[model samples]
Target: MIQRSTRFGHLLRSFRDAPSSSSSKIGGYLLASTASSPLKQACVSTNRDDEFANLDWDNLGFGMVPTDYMYIMKCSKGESFEHGQLSNFGNIELSPASGVLNYGQGAYEGTKAYKKEDGRLLLFRPDQNAIRLKNSAERMCMPSPSIDQFVDALKQTVLANKRWVPPPGKGSLYIRPLIMGSGEILGLGAAPEYTFLIYVSPVGNYFKEGLAPLNLYVEEEFDRASRGGTGGVKSITNYAPGLKALTRAKNRGFSDVLYLDSTNKKNLEEVSSCNIFVVKGNAISTPATNGTILAGITRKSIIDIARDHGYQVEEGTITVDELIHADEVFCTGTAVGVAPVGSITYQGTRMEFKTGAQTVSQQLYFTLEAIKKGLIEDKKGWIVEIDQ
Candidate 1:
């Protein structure tokens, strides 16, 4: 009974231990009309569903477009959480003194849901993203939201925003789960309170320019990860230092820059947002996730797909010269997935690759796509339904 003293705190704690048995399915969702909150500003809004249908599919871009609804929750120092409910998709309020602003303590994870041809909404590897977010919270000295609470909140949030996901083949709804310190203070200490927010946007292709083959600029001058750095973790701080080289590559008409291992620049690593891969005859290779590169879900999925298609997938230290001589190159992530690289421009020398259109790389891309779109047998049990 002592857990009842702090009200919502106990509720939050109990959420970690709740049973998730689907003894029976409930009826249609129960919608919220309005509620009161005193901790901070929190609200949800919805636009007309017709507004999304009116977009020109040919001109759509990446990132979440404004959607019909969103879910929000707030916590503060020495007070119960006043707003932890699903609502409309709208802007949220945060104080300038929030710990995330000054200490860079905020982190997020990205996952997607595809509405199947038969009308069931499927989440590809949502649990993977949930587990990764827990790692992020641990790295930042925050509590890990139990997988049950995380998944349950996601089920509630995604159901509330299911309409935002495009119909089959149109696109998907990108779900972002974020944790930030909400206790407004100027001290460099872990804030005892935090706010968890989940938002959804019906986004299409990641590259607005289209998923065409891209040219890569090999960057040995800048490093994206160190031996014991947050590079492996999806922390925001790992990005800023790599911006100079990434922007330089973009200025020269390249899609991305390859980051080399920090200790020695010879070891090939991943780009800003995607993990690297190479195809050589029948052998597929990617950098092993040795606490340096972000263990991309797509990268792992590609490995599985490759093995299933009778190819040898290898992961270890891949050098710059190895990539230059690679028969084919590709990168994978939630956003920039299975992006083919035609040539590698390292320093002043350009090495062109022969990525046979009918080769292993293209085949793996299609295989993964088929699984994501619900056209293939889900051997790994990766899909989870967000909407009933």
Candidate 2:
């Protein structure tokens, strides 16, 4: 059976379902969906407003279940980003010549909010997400929205649909803000116009029952990143190329595939959805963000936390053999948080590492969650409390 998390992994996952010639209702959530012709994937839902309040919060799997409203903003060539909002939860009009589809000038940011134990709302590192998003936009040759405006829009949007957030411990509403080139030209160039939009959806736990370590198939044939590639930025195009490789790895019964440097397949990069790390002796190491690998916010935070807690950490090119020799291995990201790697296969030689993840992984998981829920001291002031 298809898992729920994969339902809308990206801005939305395109399903094979034909665009309903007529708006036939799918349950009571989506009233009318205006999916485009040849609609590959979508999160069809409606503005019932009460949809989120009535969901089975605790049982949510992963990925957002779209609700009523979404926020949209746009910009033109040499013009500052203009405040725009789209209330209805449906598709936006993009010219066939739009850059996101043609030249692939699209970038996005991902972060989450947690319900504080006090019943107020708390956002996990909104400023960080804003900065990363702006950086992503710049990498894709798109304009950046001011940090304050981005945070303000997120706050307003979340509050407007506050009820949609799954109850604490149940799930968190994943917030995705996408900016794409709107320039409707066929030339191999940037979109003259760009559109920035934010959407919210209640999602379930990333790891359903419990955190299970993953079996990663180290891919030697396909490199996940290359010098000067757009891997440093969170671009959608970075993922599509991995689908075939990932499918093959899954067929081999591995949860994910590991990518290495394109120049030399010897160095470790990261998994398709998250950054990677290996624990050896008393030190933790991951590949350096050398233009290719994604600079994951969580990955950076983990490094700091590990150091603060007295664990040595290193960031540079890590070889596949080094990983097989690691005392423990884990992957980090916004989604799935930290997943331990039990074993990795390199050139058909399966290497098994002891389970239970690294000690730091366990410590950081609870510590991060505690900080998010406002139960512990946020030394770096990372948590942003909403709802006052």
Candidate 3:
């Protein structure tokens, strides 16, 4: 096995000698060419004999347990991404003045890889994640990798850590792609350099309640995103600020916090980490992405799936009053997947919704899961198969 220190040294040397020639400006930051070195194979072949013996796949939860490899690439002040390599998973050295640390100039994406019964691995709509990351980068004044680069890196990373992928019907490998201004800059503007990295972790469910219905706290005191803020994108800065509200809600025996629009404070926006949807009879609706709510890939897919089931789906404003009175409510995202919301409490008034095996949320969840595990035909072409 390659020593972690040795692999890090090799990575530093490669970055130091990276090329710097052509340049363009995007979002006020210099877009430069990528490093000249060919992409290196960072995934060491694993001995399959002992790979799956130690993992408790059925009991896995959403937490970070290091896997075998991670993908890394860098770009200087005026270059585009040229190459990337898989490296042994370990701690990364960073400057104290790095843009991400000082100014929060970074964005990230979350998607998952599932293991099929036939040993094939699949990714769901990674292209949507790629496009979302680029949009986030642009909003944060940072450079981003192309959709091809992003998808290729994800494939390589998943293959490298194939051993960590949970078995079919168990869990999945959660892939996180982060783009940050790695360049050291003491100023209050964009950084001079950037880094793009992808890492994977095997996870079961994000909420401790698992597939059961969730209890949500309607956050009247805290606003998740303002109208002209970074709420519409997956910027890294957008998450931490909501922790206070989330903590309070969880402490009060709630699954998560439900946020309303920052401006009106009446229109339902979304939950802290997932998008919100309401089902009334045969009609379904979710808050429109009006520059204040993150456009979720799973949310979009659920809309399509609901429509396919002959339900009338609408993307428009939904008030907290409308949400509280809906026949059923649920949340959707990469981490949460599709989770039913059983109840919501606002200013001491609590309301409950129907959630069970027959609800639309459960139906959509099962359909998506079946399609992901290759049990059903992928009619929308959403699944990207990766060769192991």
Candidate 4:
């Protein structure tokens, strides 16, 4: 069984051992909500032996599953987050004129919790996510939780929903930390209040192909982000704009859409939801984060891993011609992990890349996976263990 911290172990056990009809006291610190609502019904099983979700782990997909509890905290426009609570997994009530609904004032971060073979749960580089979330909140004109509060909330939520964590090698529990302007806002500006919430889901692979090489379509007409926009941050508004290009590409029988720079339209920016890297011989290159591309946590870790393995990695302008002539290409993100690109179709021209177990992408993927699952020593101190 996974070890819980002495401070909160008993409180978490109470959530598991309580009767379904009985009230569950998550903890004094958590200020567990006992609100009686249709969607707020507690979902945890009363049986302590029920250690895992009763589902086909092999058939999991990248979608949301209502877990036991979600973490939520709120603050005003200029106030900092002080406390949060673990409430029953349910729908949240928001005003129709909320900033998030009207003006799209929100940001979100993605991370994962891996269940090791020995019943230990591991979080990979959650601090990086916290820092990024803070940056995103500033960019979105909202308040955010401190790094300590953010990491603590993540651990508490993961432990509370431990049963939802997939078994070793099956998948992982995808964690999404969201901050939004929840207060009423009819005017065209930041709301008076903000909210931070986190929810998780067990996911297998991001793409339907499941680790297979991805076929990407280059989108030259549509731009994912501009020079001084929210593209560099994890703003909620950045994604919807790319949906048109992505949907069109999917209809054309492609895995995802790769975008080019808005100014020149000749340089590669990134894929719809992940960062891209081109490999030519022992050299690796990716688009630099120049207020357009998101500095992905996975992308940064992969670059460090590649350089540590004696590969010369560069961050600069990668033109379409350079991408087409590259030996190998891959994309990285929390959801996609490291996915190799088999072919890129740019304006009726198709360019193929090297893939399979023998490629550099595969090597980096395995190394990252090993570090995540605790199969190898985490010399970089990226893995944070949730233990008693």
Measured by lDDT, the strongest candidate is 4
Q: TM-score each candidate.
A: 0.84, 0.84, 0.91, 0.89
lDDT (10s digit) by residue, model 3, range 19-77 = 54433322122224444424422333534444453688889999998887787888886
Backbone steric clashes in candidate 4, count = 1
lDDT of 4 by residue, 1-388 (tens): 2332453434434554544345544522223323332113333334434789788998999988888778877778877776565766766767788899999999999999999889999999999999999999999888888787898889878877888999999999999999999899898999998888999999999999999999999998899999999889999999988999999999989999999999999999999999999999999999999999999999999999999999999999999988767999999999999999999998899999999979999999999999999999999999999863
Kindly list the per-residue Cα lDDT of model 2 for residues 337-385, writing each as its tens digit: 7777778999888887666634667877777778777878999988887
- lDDT agreement with native, every candidate: 0.72, 0.73, 0.85, 0.87
Candidate 1 lDDT, tens digit per residue, 223-273?
Answer: 898988888888767788888998899999888888888898888889888
Model 4 misplacement above 4 A: 1-24, 27-48
Candidate 2 has which clashing residue pairs, if any?
14-40, 14-41, 15-40, 15-41, 30-45, 30-46, 60-204
Distance from true location, Cα of 134 in model 3, Å: 0.5
Ranking by TM-score: 3, 4, 2, 1
Candidates 1 and 4 compared: the better one by lDDT is 4
Better of 3 and 4 by lDDT: 4
